[model samples]
Target: MFLYFLTLVLMVMGLYCLIAKKNIVKKIIGIVIMEYSINLFLILIGYKKDGIAPILLKNVSVEELTSRGVDPLPQALVLTSIVIGLGTLALMVAICLRIYEKYKTFDMSKINKLKG
Candidate 1:
């Protein structure tokens, strides 16, 4: 509903930041924003109204669990994605730092112009 719309908007914003910004740091931030929005979208997909944890209980029937339980797959997938995203972010930052060490600037345009 509204959440889905917001997620889409957030994704667009992230894309705009990534494409329109010239600062390497800003681009990194944009990548993080996009990653967060994607994670949010995945979480939203697994959401259910009045849903209970996806767990098996002795008293709960299989049909009831199937009907009422929130999906666990999306949650698991999001968790894995988050870990991967973090690793990528770290790698990006490391590369950015190395670039800064070499060029003494975070501006991508300057870096391009100064390349020798």
Candidate 2:
């Protein structure tokens, strides 16, 4: 519902920042936003209305667990994605720091001096 549109808007905002921002750090942040938005979208896609945790209890029927419980796969996938995102963010920051060391600036335009 509203959440889908919100996630889509967030994705677009992230894309805009990534493409239009001139600061390297801002671009990195945009990448993170985009990643998060995608993760949120995935979680929403796997959502079940009136869903409960996918836990098995002795009193609960297998059919109830199957029909009423939320899918655990997406949650697991999101966890993995978060870890991967962290690694990616760290790599991006490390690269940014190296670039800053070279140009003494975080501005992408200013770093163009290295083109020569």
Candidate 3:
């Protein structure tokens, strides 16, 4: 219950940062935070109370392996997600830098040229 609450809190905080912040850099940070929170939640979902590593030995039977090993799918998924997040963060930061170069400011409010 407590973990769920914490997850919700993290998600809400990220959303608040993304929505309320005026700086483009801060918005990118918020997006990164949101991605991390989602990855954490996904990893937590696959965790077992008392589980062993999912290494396979020659003598280990299939049933024993299934009973004692931790789930590997979530770890793999999280790794892929982290890679994707890194790519996205890099793109966002590049765009923010370009924006800063053009406007010489980080505040989005100052970038009012598109308003019509």
Candidate 4:
């Protein structure tokens, strides 16, 4: 669908940001964008038109549940991925801050030149 194509485009944009940017913060933002795009893709994979939540109600038959329920696995995976992404983002920002403290610049080329 168009959504999948959009997701791919978003990922490519993120990749471009990661590869083409010079600032450490911008690179970090690119990584976050890529992560978010992947999460969006996963969510799209599990989506169903006119689907209900996977939760079972007393009145719902097994057949009906199977026919209409959206998948829960991808949602769970996305939740876990979000937590992991947050941790990684924090770590990256901390490293960037330390690099700035040492080099006085967020520019990668400058940082490389200043490296002892």
Best candidate (score: TM-score): 4
Q: Model 3, 19-79: lDDT tens per residue?
A: 9999988888888888888998888888876777788888877787799888999999999
Q: For model 2, how does the per-residue alpha-carbon lDDT over 1-116 read when each residue is reduced to its tens digit?
A: 99999999999999999999999999999999999999999899789999989999898899999999998998999999999999999999999999999889999988774454
lDDT of 3 at 29: 85
Worst 10 residues of 1 by lDDT: 107-116
Ten residues in sequence with the least summed lDDT for candidate 3:
1-10
TM-score, one value per model: 0.91, 0.91, 0.89, 0.93
**Model 4 misses residue 63 by how many Å?**
2.4
Backbone clash pairs for candidate 2 read none
Q: Write the per-residue lDDT of candidate 1 for residues 12-107, one digit (tens) a residue.
A: 999999999999999999999999999999999999999989889898889989999999999999999999999999999999999999999998
- Give lDDT: candidate 1, residue 90: 98
Decide which is better by lDDT, 2 or 4: 4
lDDT of each: 0.94, 0.94, 0.88, 0.95
What is candidate 1's TM-score against the reference? 0.91
> Which scores greater on lDDT, model 2 or model 3?
2
The residue pairs found clashing in candidate 3 are none
lDDT comparing candidate 1 with the true structure: 0.94
Q: Candidate 1: lDDT of 33?
A: 95
**Candidate 1 to native Cα RMSD, angstroms:** 2.0
